[model samples]
Target: MSRQLLQEPVQDLLDALTKSEGPDILSTFTTSPKPLAHEHGLPQLAPFLGRSFHGQEGISAYFDLLSTYLQIENMKFEPEETWVIDESCMAIALRGTATFTWKETQHSWEETFAYRIKVAEDVSDDSEKNGSLKVCEYQIWADTGAAYLASLGNLDDMPE
Candidate 1:
């Protein structure tokens, strides 16, 4: 697909993320009734990290944990840098500054991260962007070190 064909879907997904509410973003993911997210539940790595968020209910739980424990402020993605690999896959690295806070510890710091996303056409309701693209998978490559330190309330103390 041409980059132009994906601009709307990508922008819509990003907007949903910025909104950061579970319901607001779920539609951006898909219109199918089946579970869409597949994640490796990494509880040992972070408290908010769920093993896998399956369906809508699971998605809600996943976001709840995140909202309860972390605050992502000013998170930005470089659209110009998004690498579209065929029509079903894309790799886009986060190249902007964002303050990530572990809410329980009140630890906040800026970090750069990356994520890979997959988008596909959804022929569901026109309400979902008139059969435009929908996100199939979203994989985050966050700064685990920073996340861990922040979770322990020690990120700020770590030296650059």
Candidate 2:
């Protein structure tokens, strides 16, 4: 697999996620199944908020929790920079905007997100039985305080 080939699967996964389609997103994972780790940097006050999720089931649960607190009206990603570290690894510096409704308060968040994705070992094979490339790790560096406030209907206290 060439470096250029690595970008397709990552882009496909991002597209599925931006659409908020759980099933479609899950189809991109490897056959042996690895955890899709999501880490959120939140204040100590939000203990119920999860900092990590494991496997497909955990990933599903995480998405379910997110849906309960907010509805993503729109999500767009602009890759300002991307590095193909290898045939199976890639990193992207993406700037994106998300318009969502939290606690009935609509808000738009524009931030830069970093992603490190790894393709499955068998991804080089185009056979149907072969596994697909998936995101093994994802990290979001965003203003969680504003999100938390919005979720609690405390928009008045949110930073400008």
Candidate 3:
């Protein structure tokens, strides 16, 4: 796709992340519903997750865990660098420091946040812009985050 076509979507997604607008940002990126587990179960387990297996999952899971951790640590985003691009896919790389409101929690917290995410639009064989814009592998990434991370264990993992 021409780099110009991706500009708006990339900017909008980055703005959503910078503002920490949860469902708003997620909806643009996924087809499946946001799983209820992270919403209902996170706050209760916030203080206990440091030893949790983070890297075992993909980047979205990492972000979920990271988001939960930020809430626990009371960190807020203070974006440093924000760049938008359209290479093989539309992407945005953002870096920022999080400012924390210290709570009584024992976890040592930093007053900064840094993140880099790439958001791309799905282009199917029947998509309107298929010939004008680069097709993106967005569905592959979305399927994993929307379906896989919410499950946490194999019992809930979506079958290929």
Number of the predicted model whose lDDT against the real structure is largest:
1
Per-prediction TM-score to the true structure, in the order listed: 0.77, 0.72, 0.39
Model 3, CA-based lDDT: 0.36
User: Which digits, one per residue and each the tens of the lDDT, describe model 3 over residues 35-141?
Assistant: 11122124233432323221113325645654653443333333323344545745544334443321233223233333333434444344453333221212111
Per-residue CA lDDT of model 1 for 30-92, tens digit only, reads 554333454344568786453666655766676787788788899777755445445445433
Q: 1 or 2, which is superior by lDDT?
A: 1
Runs in model 3 deviating more than 4 A are 2-4, 20-23, 32-67, 72-86, 101-114, 123-160
lDDT of 2: 0.59
Task: Give the clashing residue pairs of candidate 1, or none.
Answer: 41-51
Instruction: Identify the runs in model 2 with alpha carbons over 4 angstroms from their true place.
Output: 20-23, 43-50, 79-89, 104-112, 122-131
C-alpha RMSD of candidate 1:
3.5
Query: What's the C-alpha lDDT at position 83 in model 1?
Result: 51
The TM-score, computed over Cα atoms with residue i paired to residue i, of candidate 1 is 0.77
Question: Candidate 1 vs candidate 3: which has greater lDDT?
Answer: 1
Q: On TM-score, who's better, 1 or 3?
A: 1
lDDT of 2 at 151: 61
